[model samples]
Structure formats: structure tokens, C-alpha cells
Target: MNDSFKKIAKTIKKSNSIALFTHISPDMDALGSSMSLYYAIKSLGKKVSIFVKDNITETQATLVDTNVFEKDCNQSEYDLFISTDTPSQKRLGDYAKIFIAGQRKIVLDHHLNDDLKGDLNFVDTSYSSCSEISYQVIKELKVKITPQIASYVFMGLSSDTNAFTNSNTNASSFKTAYELTLADADITNINELLYKTHTTKEIDLKKFLYNNYHLENGICFCLVTCNDLKKLNATKADCDFFSSELINMQGANFAFSIIESTPSFYEISLRSKHGYNVRDVAEKFGGGGHICAAGAKLKYESIEKLKDTLVDTIKYSGE
Candidate 1:
């Protein structure tokens, strides 16, 4: 990755304009990598356009300026299209055509089973968070890591690792945290926003999870229907932490959250402790991610059918 990093740096240095993208339903790792790279590229006096779909979460607004994401752009205008933290074409939403149309393509991701290829690919599953890779790329680009950049990178690293309590956290993650701290990362604010603060809506969602989750055969799971969201006055953001929390159960080896964003449409967020693998389960549903943490979004005929099938899959296959 060292030589590849330098090569990507050279490519960025030569490009006059660049477009940046991340997966839809962006998480902190996705936003942190894209936003930090956007600023780093802009500081080099290059034109930058970033596109992200479904900016429907409050946490997203708190981390980056969603206003900067371009609604439309002629892909031909950019010399390079760089995708960060996005692993597949469908994950790009409608922007896949734009990336395909770019004069050059670069992929910076840390996910498994990638379907989105690039002229310059740097996909490494060893990374704990895409922000760690972004920090290295920013360093290679010779961009000074200001407090703002440090804070953004820190947010992604901490969030993805669940404040470094997750299985993915490693020496590299801690090293990045140390470096970001030296660069004056605003960890205090990020901690407050990500971990400490929770609205009444989130509290209600948590209570519902406590009352509703099913624990069977060492699998703890919850299914939050669209009607549940309406009754609670909450959104998908409120349920983001449910899967992680479920995995924290002492007796559970596998945990999953099935969220119905719309009727007959479900988003599966899977987590596994004790070395159980869930990435294959996500891939079976046409989704892919890390081993311990993975997700897939698909439509089903009914919530009951989806739950039954997913539970059986985990029982017979995911373990």
C-alpha cells in the first residue's frame, strides 16, 4: 500500500479537478473519509465536487456540511472521480454512471467483497475504518492536518470502532488516534455528539429494542418496522446503534437489526461477537462489508418472511 499511496498522491497532484463520492446511507466512516478528503483536495487549489445521496440523518448534518454535496454534475468536467468507503456500484446509487464517465477513477475503501473497481484501486480490508486510510492518503497528498481534518478523521475512527471497544480496533487505529490527538483533533466534541448525546426519540427507540428484541440460539435480533418509527417519531439514525448494542449482550454470539425503511423494504445491520462471520450473510443478500460488522439492504415480501429467513440463514449458515 505504500507504493500505491504515493501513486495516488501523484495522481491527485496532477489532476486539475476531482469529484468525490461515498455510499448512500453514509455512516461516520463514509462521511469522515469523503469530507476530510474533500477539504484536503480543495486546499490544493483543485476544483472538487462531492455527491452523497439520502442525507436524511441528523448525525450526518452535525459532522459535515451536507450543502456541499452536488445534486447534479457533468462527470466529464472532472479529471478524476474518487470514491471513498463505497464498495459496490449500486452503493453509489444513481452516481455510478457519473463515476463510470470520469476520465479516471480511484477507489479508497476498506470493505470486503468489492464490486466497484477503479483505474487506481486501494482497497484494504485490514483497515479498521476508512478514515484511517483517508488520513494516510491525506498525509501522502502532503495536506496539513488541521484541527478540523483531525476532528473529522477522529469521528470516523471512533464511531466505527464504537469508541475503540469493537473487535476491529487495532494498533493502527490507536496510532491514528494518537497522531490525530497530536494534531489537536476535537475528540471532546465528537465524543459528545456521537456517544454522550441522545434525544428522547433515541431513548424511546432503545426502550423498544429492549422490549422487542428476540434472543434465540445465541442470536439477539430486532425488527423495527416503518410503523414503529412513525409511532416513536424516530428515524433510522435512532436505530443505528441497536445492532451494536445487541452484540454486546453477554450471551449473544450474533446480533442483527432489521429496519424497514419503507413498506416491503428492509435494511439489515449485522454484528457478530466470538469470531462469528456475518459478511457472507450480507453478501448472500447482495450486500458486503467487514466480518464483524456488515450490512445489506433489500426488499422482502413481508417482515415475517424476512425475519424467519434471516434467522434460519444465521442458524444454519452464518455460524
Candidate 2:
């Protein structure tokens, strides 16, 4: 086993109780990886629990059953805490305290920019998802990855890669999927849970963007005002994948979506064409992700000023 993988396996082997966690506002990738890791450890006859900063949207809740293990934030007595898909400690949200206070911890993540603060860290920026990392760790430990594990990890990779369309996917990802399929993973059922369950509200939100969003300088941008969100009856999760659609727009160099999370706060999402790096843009505004996909949050007094600032930044940077 590799040094990093050994470190994690050793930690798991020594611990009696394991508490698994993911980033705030858990997406499929984050949730899948955490849950899959939880199950893997539990199959080893260890006590395990999974916790999230907030409840996942109903759409995601239906897809993955978090009830498989006990769920809560009280980790004062837990033996090991595992943080998945979180690039930094700050992104842990309310659970930051538990992560800091926990005596033993491990972090499995795929973000390019990670300020990992863990006793054992397994980070691979090149990998498509943290679920992929979970797979590797389990394989190195010589544990059997069952069909249920495969389905969850596949959901993680498929969701993060937009079903393998993103640039992060590689030959290893395909081989991993194939190996998992051999283990009895039902690809059709996984896809049905992951992608085929969009709600009418989400569809209406997408239709609104299709009709009103605009593109400039080969960069497509859209704004979801608080009023628009209210009208559409959509939550932040509903619009998570909204910006990815723009990246594929013919001749577009970058795609962006800004959502008014509060009157004074805006969350921005950016996606890029082949050569561009969205992380640079996100870093400018104190956010970060991969080269092609990234995000940032801005607090402004006026929406028009925020819009102008974003447009000016993108236009002048020539990104």
C-alpha cells in the first residue's frame, strides 16, 4: 500500500468508532464519497457515523440514504473523524469544531487547492471525485468493494464529472467504473437516482435561464436574483449545475452564474473552456476549485455594482 493509503488504513484499523463528514451543502460527490467510506468501514465491523453541516436537498436525500448510520454533530467521544471533499477546514462549516477537537482524523479530497489539516490526508487533484479516493484507499487495504459501494462511488464520479463529460475523467476512472460494474453495480439504477430525478421547480428554473440569460465575448453569464429564486421556488441546490450547461455553449470561453443568496451576498459559479482556469477567477474573490470549475462569494451593497464588478473582472482579465 502507498504511504498515504497506509496512513489512513492504519488509522481506521486502530479506531473503534469512526465519524465521517463532507463539505457544507453536500453535493452528490461529497455525500456519495462520505457514505461509501462510512459503509466500507462499517463492513469491517467498526462503529461508524456520518454527519453533514446541513440537510441535503430533497432530490439528493431521495437518492442516497444517510440513515444507514447514526447521524449527528456530537463527536466528542468519537474515535476517528474523516473529512471528505472539503478543501480546507473553513469549508467544514459548523462542524469545524469537531474536526479541530477530534484526536484522530483523515481527509480524502480531490480539490486542486487544498489546505489540508489532518493527521492523514489523501488528496489527488487529478482524480475526478473523492469517491475515487475512497475506492483506492479501500483497494489498498485489500477490502472487498461490494456492489452498494460501487454504486455510491460511481454516483460520486458521475455527478462531479457531469456524467463523465468534465475534463477530470481519465482512463483510470473508466477502469474503476468497469471494476465496480463487475462487482454488481447497476449503472442504470445509479443514473436513475443521480440524474433522472430533477424536479419541476428545477426545470422551470432552467427554462427561465434559457430564455433570459445572455452571453458575451464567448462567455455566458446568468444572474439569479432573490426575486427570481422566489418566483421559481428554487433553492441554491437547484441551481448548482445551472452554470455547467453554459460551458458547453458553442464558442463560449467561460460560463458564469451569480446567485443572490441574500440581499448583500452573492455566490458566483464559473466554468471554463479548454485553456481557461476558473480557479484564478474564484481565487480573486476568495473562492477556489479546479481549473475548469470554481466558485466565490461576494458581499456588496447593490446587485448592479456586483454585476459590474464581475463583468469588468472577467472582461479585463481576458480569461
Candidate 3:
């Protein structure tokens, strides 16, 4: 609809081979948007490859064709590189090199981080999800939005908006969802897969969260140590939505879930309600995300120290 979108369409039209990428620790939005674009580009007879450096969560994996992603790819092979849902190039992990190697690069994102790294950038923070922007881009390319593509787009929209329950959901998100449905996207299956189904291990993790959690200064928080994960035979994927679950507490203004991925490396997920901006809290620890939902990773020392620091950070930021 604008000059940039037209340029992006032209770029994709001119390219023969395209590589699609999302940030590391791929979520439903990242995977969904990337896969949706992949299908759209492939339909144009362009050689397309999607790369993911990390294992996708089982919940997100169910939404699309996972076989299209190659964990290992030659960075120098692609003609055009497109990054979706990634705020910055550093978040690409090992796949950043592909972006650097490509003859041209484009970025489609919804985060406030506007440090544009792509040759052609489309960063719209007003949109609910990058998938929403991607849907528009795919349409601009004049590619027929197939049922599979619509399903992938719908998964991204649903996941990032928490099935349209989060603060980011708006009129545009609903309109996009309706369009995807008209294209034959399976909204029923997408909702059931993302929200309704949970494995025994996942259920155990939820139980553990309820049994062991702390509430202070309007922050409901929990820590899952590597030992705890091992005892429960659960992976980080099993605790995927724990932070969101924490924010569901009766009086919680915000929530945090800190997971020790290794002996000294910890990953944190934060969610906020009541107009709290968790992004500022996440940025304090070298992480970035949306206003209401964000994440960070830090080195573990002692649980007490980490908890104290985070409590102070969230309290200070929220005020």
C-alpha cells in the first residue's frame, strides 16, 4: 500500500532464491510468520528455505510444516534474506550470517526496537504481530493466499495475542483473523492445539508452578531450576506459558518465570497486566520484547540474589 511495501514486493519478485528467518528460541508467532512467508514465496517458484537455530516448542511445531526448516544452512546461498518477528539481528543467533551474506535483506517486525538492519525494513509497532504485517506483504506480492498459508498466519496472530486475550489484540487483529478464516484457515484446530491440549509433563509443570511460586509487590514470580526440570522430566518447552499463567493470579500486576537452562545460565519470561511495561524490565537484563510481554536471560548466582535483583527492577520500572 506504501512505497516500502511496493519495494519489498518488487524485491521478492526479482529474487530467485529466498531464505526466511526468525529469532532464536522460536515461538508460535516467529515460526508461524516465517513458515507462512515460506509457503507464499515457494508458491512463486522461488527456492525458499527457512532456518531455525533452536528447537521449536512442540506446541508451535504442531501449527505448520516443520520439515521446511533447516537447522544448518549455507549462509552464502540465498539471493534474498527476509527476517520476520525478530527485533534485531543479534536475536538471529547463528542465522545472522545468512542475513549478512544475502544480496538483499528485508525485515518485517512489530517490536519497538527500530534499529533497522535490513536493506528494506518494515517495522510497524502498531500491528499486533509480525504475522499481521507478513500477511499484508504476502498479499502485496500478488501470491494467492492458500489455506496452509492462512493457517500459519492465523497461528501467529493467535499465539502472539494469546488467542486474542492479550492487550495487543485490536480491531486489526480481529479483521486479519476473519480474513484468514475466509481463506479456509482452521481456527478450531489452531485454538485447540495451542490452548486446549497439554501433555502430562506440561500439566506437571503447571502444578509445580502453582505449588511453588512467590507473590510480592504486585509481581507473581516462580523459578524453575534445571534440577527441578530434570526431576519432572520436563524440558523448557513444557514451561512455555508459565509466565502468562503467573499473570493470571488474582492480584498480580505482572509475572515472571525464571528457568535455569544450564548450571549457571538462566532464561526469564515476563508478562504484565494493569498497564505495566515488562519490556523495560527485560531490557535491563539484555532482553527485549513487546510492552506487555518480554523476556531476558542472565547468569545464575544464587536464587536469592536473582530474585532480589528482579524484584527491585520490576518494582522500580512499574512505578
Candidates in order have lDDT scores of: 0.87, 0.80, 0.85
Each prediction's RMSD to truth = 1.5, 2.1, 1.6
The sequence of per-residue lDDT tens digits that candidate 1 reaches over residues 110-185 is 8863678888988888888998888888999998899988888998899888899888889999999999999999
TM-score of 2: 0.93
Error of 3 at 209 (Å): 0.9
The local distance difference test score of model 1 is 0.87
1-319, model 3: which lDDT tens digit per residue?
1237778988999998888889888888898889889999999999999988687666666776777778777766788899999986678888776676678889889987634478888888898889998998899889999999999999999989989988899999999999999999988999898888987767788889999999987899999888998998877767868999999998999899988888878889999995789999989988888888998877868666787898899888946
TM-score of 1: 0.96
lDDT of 3: 0.85
| Candidates ranked by lDDT | 1, 3, 2
Clashing pairs in 2: none
Model 3 ranges with Cα > 4 A deviation: 1-3, 114-116
Q: For every model in order, what is the number of clashing pairs? A: 0, 0, 0
lDDT of 3 at 27: 86
Q: Residue 38: error of model 2 in Å?
A: 0.7
